[model samples]
Target chain A: MSVLVYTENWNGKFKKLSFELASYASRLAEMLNMDPIAVSIGQVDRDELEKLAGYGIKKMIAIENDALKQFDTQTYTKVIADIASRESAKLLVLANNNAGKSLAPRLSVRLKAAVASGVGQLPEKLSPFVIKKRVFSGNALAGLELRTETKIITLAQNSFDLIEKPADMVIEKAEADLAGIAPKTSIKDVQIQTGKLLLSDAEIVVSGGRGMKSPDNWGPIEELAGLLNGATACSRPVSDEGWRPHEEHTGQTGKIIAPNLYFAIGISGATQHLAGISASKYIVAINNDKDAPIFEAAQYGIVGDATKVLPKLVEALRKAKSA
Target chain B: MNILVCISQVPDTTTKVKFTDNNTRLDTTGIQWVINPWDELSLTRALELKDDASSGVAKVSVALVGPVSTEPTIRKALAIGADDAYRVDTEALDAYQVAAQLAEVVKAGSFDIILCGIESSDYNGSNVGGMLAEFLNYPSVSGISNLDVKDGQVQVSREIDGGKEMIALPTPFVGIVQKGIAKEPRIAAMRGIMMARKKPIQIVESAPVEPLSQTLAFEPPQPRPACNFIDPDNPEQLITLLQNEAKVI
Candidate 1:
């Protein structure tokens, strides 16, 4: 039996997430005393595939097909299930991102493998296979047990560190027969957001809430984010009131992010909002209310009017960068 | 055309989560139940489609896998203009079990369009819609932000890695929706609330499907250190602390 990891690529290039999955799978393979194998679908360069070797992935399978160019959950699940069965994979690991979330459940059904989504930690026990994951939107943690012969897990992003253990890797080409299979859905158009750091991929995030007072008062938030080379986000009410785009909303109902540094300006943190950013390494909150819930979760806080404090902080940051 | 929206009852967002029974179960004391926020938005979108005559949407129904205690939350969905509801008589143990149960409901009542929230706020499992589609052998679209149906054709815009992708699919598909499916969830009107009392809630026996995973225990997140308050009068000091102390900037 082998441990299999699915490495996802975008535009024929792998991201840091793929390396993280490889690192996770290598450690898991060690625990189970099994070989670690990675499967990369779509088009990726051979040199790029060699990068997995640094994370201890020795065997890699590449499946290139015109029909598999676009991501279809159903088709991808079928392909991965075939690989898992052929390799006799006892455990399958995937990143808990958009594509992974869409594919894991279907694969679970196809393989009849018990799935534990958003797992944050490695398993401490293998007899009954128990792991921990965030629950109640990060308000709490739940310990879960997988009671099946085969197991599948989706690792939460940024939860595991990428540890390099160099190894000699071999690439294998596999062809999937798609004669009678076809996707029921087709992509009519794709609009990729360009020239901006995506919130999910950012290390620092500057966010605001209703306390910013008006949509017109967003200049400081943008300026601060630009100076820090970070992304900008907002609370749900800010998006609901049209102060910011819905895509910028961060909460339990919206995007969940875990940046290295998060600035919550003029935002009184609600539980739902806190849930989204709880994974952040360090949180800094600025609010007029000293008792705002955001302060409780933040590592550093400034209790004053954001309108008075924001511009001054921006100027200070500008000067510091130049110094 | 017929539409079905799956709903789940969750603790109010403001309610503080607490565990009982040696951290094995959620404490229900003093807790207020409400419809999952994402499910509410999905139901709102379904009703909006039914409200339009040109869309040819004739009925909007809801389904839930819960016990009798969840009826109040199910009634709230009907009050918000769902024509009727189906309640599977059992507590949802896991995502697979819940999806299996919901598949039976969908098989019994033929629905052209099915809507499910991306994930429940309580468990944040994010598995049901895709698993349910697999159970019924139907196509499913995840991360749906906008959905429109015209002339019996279903089109949805889903959020991908950096942007959105517009997809066109036929009938009998599942849409796992997040925010932006509707501008905002609609509030129940007085007349709608009064009429909802007469609507029927069909209770089906739970299917004998075993759960794939089990929850061992629950615990609160580790508490953060106390906040170090920087003097607001000296705004530059905060930047210095961030640079020299926090080292984030």
Candidate 2:
């Protein structure tokens, strides 16, 4: 038996999550005393597939067909399940992102395996297969043990460390036929937001809350994030009020991010909002209320109006980064 | 269209999470319970579709896989505008078990559409909806923010990495919706609350299924370090601390 990692590609190039999944699968395989294999669907560069050798993948398989150019969850699941059955994969690893979250559950049901999504850490004990994950909006942790023979886990973004070790990786092309079934869903159109750091890969974030007052005041927030080479996020209320897109909302009902630094401007830090950002290494809260709950979680606090403090802080950071 | 919306009751967001029974069970003393925020949004959207004639939605049913303690929460949902309610007499064991139980209910009833939040607020497993689709052998679309129904088909918008993708599917599909699905939830009006008292609530026996995973214990996260207040007058000093002290710069 071996471990299988589903590597994702977008627009013919590999994503950062592809490397993270390879690294995670390699470590898990070492603990289970099994080889780690990567399965890729659709078009990905052969050289990019070969680069997985640096992450300790022993075998890589790429399945390519004209019909596979676009992502169809049903077709992808069928192909991956076939591969796992043929290889007798004991553990399946994927990133808990848009595609993985939708595919992992169906794969678990097809394979009759115990499934864990958004896993926060590696296995603590192999005998019982214990793992820990965040629960209650990151306020508490739950230690769960899988009871099934085979298990599927989707690792949270930025949760695990990537360790690289070169290995001799062999690439093989797989034969697949999609003539039997028809895909139910088809993508009619795609609108991609460009020139902004994705929340998943962002190392630093500058977020605003209701205290920012108006959507028109978002210029400084975006400017600050741009100056730091970071991403911009907002609280749930801001998104609900239509000040920002729901994709930029960072809270319990939104995206969970763990960056190196998180700047909370004019945020009061509700529990739901705190749950999504507890993983940040350092937190800085700038608000007018000294007793705001954000101060309890932040490492530094500045009690002032965001409109007055944000411009000065932006100018100062610009000078600091340039020098 | 017969739409089934799955929901769960969770501890209030402000309550401090604690454990009891040697850390195996969630501590309930003094904690207020409310309907999960994500599920609330789903219910609101389902009700909107049911009320609008052009949507072709005939009935909206709310289901909960929990004990009698959830009756009050279920009643609250009916008050908000569900045509009916279903309660499976069992505890929510895990994601797998929950999916199995809900799947059995969906199979027994003739439902054309199933709606649920992407994940619950407490466990955040994010697997039940997809698993249910697998059990029922139906197409599932998740992270959908917008939805429309026409001519027995569904058109949806789901979140992608840097953008959004629009998808189209036929009837008998599952959708795991998130926030942008609807506006803020509607509160239970006094008249609706009184009307909900007489609505039909069918209690069904839960399907027997063993849980695939067990929680061993609960632990609180490491406490944040002490905070140092910065002088707002000197913005440059804070920049210096970010570079020298935190070193994040």
Candidate 3:
């Protein structure tokens, strides 16, 4: 059979995670000698799904309906499970987004399969059912296997980079019956009531700590994060001190992330904090303390005051880009 | 409310995780154990419910399935304000097995509402709550940051990818509590400790339903490479380093 991937979106528009999931499913399908099929849902159109051909997807199947606009978990789960059953899909993949958060488990139950969430890589596919996934909130990797015939796994956001191929892939819409059931849950409104910070899927992350001193002075960090098209994160102390919302906290106790570039500003990293993002490709620590623990884990360290250094770095990037 | 709160005693978060001599087994000696930090949030919330319902009127019970070392952790829940506690005295630690234990306990109690940590601090698997829901055949909402109960139902708002998701579920459902639930957990006071003396801890011996796929030894990550300091003031030098030395940009 083939591998099935769930496409993701934000405000009815395709998101970066859709491409990443397609890429991951493509590779996993290759390793398993199976074809890759992406099931694009929500307000996404066929053209948007077909555009993911660059990720090496063989076919894009769109399931369109007005009720399918927002992320209603019951209807979404029903649609996915129904499609996977018809395809006899061996492995079902989903992006570890909020939609997948509730949908994955519900889909797993409907399909009667074992689910492995937060997966980081393809399985061994040999005698054992081994797949390496991040555990303990990305602190460590667990080598696990799914012995069940029908397997479902969710990919951690940004764990895999999509390769862009020039040739276009085929697109087809699937007319599926999700059956009749009143949705017990409702997504009332799409609230875009946050700042410029998009932590879950940002490529670059600029985080602050207790060193920022106060919330009023956080304007510079926010500006730098905005300029870089990155997100803002914080250490435990900052969240603990209420300088930033606890939702922004990234650590073993908070949300785990793995951005391409992580900028630690005025924060001394702790192991618990490092557990959340040690997978970041490049880490830059900007702390005045020469012996801060973050420096030990950081690829590049800046031993200077953040107040004096961050502004100049921002200015330098802007000037260098123009000149 | 028939509040059934599930907990697991894990190595304290601050512990320096070290492998044993063979680099296989985790170093067990002298490691302090506490309720998983996320699970502690569930305890805090459960206690709040108990206080709100006036104790015996609407009952609260703590359920855990782990080794006997978790007795104190169960007692800690009692001290924190659960009416009683139950610990499945088994050595199995697999996610499926643990979820089965919770399912059996849930089926027996017929809870109106259930609360559990989103994931275990030690296992970090984040599968138990979902697995329990799957086994017991019920709906579950996880990663809940703030929750309240009203009108024969519970309402919860969870931290989603870009924003927040709020859902309200009727009785007979599970909600996995997230860390930093509400605010910092309150300390166990002298009264809680005194009341815990009267609470009974019931231990049951039950066979594991099924073990999960094998898990390899815990491996502490390799130490990071040496840090290279650059002067942020010298943008030219930093840019060169990023391009040539680190090659991140």
Candidate 4:
């Protein structure tokens, strides 16, 4: 028996989450004293798949099919369940990302395995298989127990570290019977966001809230982020008000980010907004109200209007860089 | 065209979360409940579609997987312009069971489209919509920001890893909606509130199923560290602190 990890890739390249899954699965395999196997779908460069070798993956299984170019939840779930059954995997791991969140529950239903999503930490106990996850929108943590023969866990995004434990990996290609696989959905077109740093890759993030007043006031915020080479984000209200794009929203109901440094301008730090950003290593807030809830969570606070403060801060950073 | 929006009641975002019953149950001593913000957006969009003369939407209904204690929440959804509401009387059902129950409701009704929040505020599982789609054998699209329907086909814009994708599906599909689906959540005016009191909230018995996962215990988050205030006049000092102390720049 082996532990299987479903490595997710996009555009013929593996995402950061693939390494994290491989790293965490390797650790889980060591605990269970079994070989860790990585399985992927669609077409990706074999050389790119080899990168998982450093994360303790002993075998990489690639199942390529022309029909599998795009991600289909039903097709992927059926294929994964078939492979897991064949290998007799006791534990399955995935990243709690957009794809994982949509696939895990359906996989559980098909495989009859107990599934847990948004798991924030390693399993607390092996025998009972208890995992800790954020609940109540990050206001509290819940310890969950899954009593099943096979357990599926989706790791929260940016929760674990990727350590290099190099291994000589063996790559295998399996020819599977993918007949009669009809997906209900079809892609009509795709438009990619261009010329901006992805939020997941940025070390620093510059964010604003409704305190910015209107969409017209976003010039300084964007300029500040441009100077720092950081991604731009906003609170839920800002997105709801149409002041910014929805993808830039970071909060409990939005994207969860774990940047090393986060700059909050004109934000009050509501519990929902704080839930998405609590993972940031350090937070700096620029709000006029000293008693704003953001100050309680921020490491550094500047009680001033962002309209006046952001321009000066940008200027200072520019001068520092040039000097 | 019949539209059904799945909504859940959650503790207000500002509530001080607490647990009781050996940390297995949420404390409800003084907690205030509201329609989950994500679902509020979905409901608003549903109402907008119903109001559009050319959208072909005939009625808007809401579904909830909760006990009778959530009737007030259902009434609030009706006040926000949903024509009817259905509640499955149950508590603490897992994601799988919740989806199954919702699938049963969908099967009982003639719905052309289904919508739900990307995930709930409490559990944040982000599973029910897709799972429901699987059970009903309907196409499911999660993280959809915009949706347009014409001639029994829907064209949607979905947020992906680093970009966006547009997909088209036939009628009777499930959409997990996010912020871009609606600009603002509609508020219940006095007339709508009065009308909601007379609206029907149909209570249905839930079919029981074993939960695959169970909550064992709970723990509050660690207290945040103290903050250090800086004068706004010295912007240069802020840069120095970020470079030397934070080491992030």
For model 2 the TM-score comes to 0.94
- Residue A273 deviation, candidate 1, in Å? 1.6
Residue A217 accuracy (lDDT) in model 1: 93
RMSD of each: 2.2, 2.4, 3.0, 2.7
Q: Give per-candidate clash totals.
A: 0, 0, 1, 0
Candidate numbers sorted by lDDT from highest down:
1, 2, 4, 3
Quality class of the docking in candidate 3, CAPRI style: acceptable
DockQ of 2: 0.65
Worst 10 residues of 1 chain A by lDDT: A193-202
Enumerate residue pairs that collide in model 1: none
* Chain A TM per prediction: 0.91, 0.90, 0.92, 0.89
For each candidate, the DockQ is 0.67, 0.65, 0.44, 0.61
lDDT per residue for candidate 1 within A172-289, as digits (tens), equals 9999767677988899998886535667657789999988999999999999988988889999999999999887888887777777789999899988899888888789999999
> What do the candidate models score in CA lDDT, each in turn?
0.89, 0.86, 0.74, 0.84
- Worst 10-residue lDDT window for candidate 2 chain B reads B145-154
lDDT minimum window of 10 residues, candidate 1 chain B: B156-165
Chain B TM-score, one value per candidate, order as shown = 0.93, 0.92, 0.89, 0.90
lDDT (10s digit) by residue, model 3, range A225-318? 8767788998889898898987788887776777878888888888788877786768888888998888988888888887778778777767
Error at B198, model 3, angstroms: 2.9
Given the true complex, what DockQ would model 1 score? Answer: 0.67
Candidate 2 per-residue lDDT, tens place, A1-323, comes to 99999988876677556777888999999999999999988788898899889999999989998777767777788888899988889999988876888899999989988887787678989889888888887888889898888999998766776779798999999976677867888888988877577674577899999989899988889998888888899998898888998778888767777777899998899888998888777899999999999999999989999878888889888888788
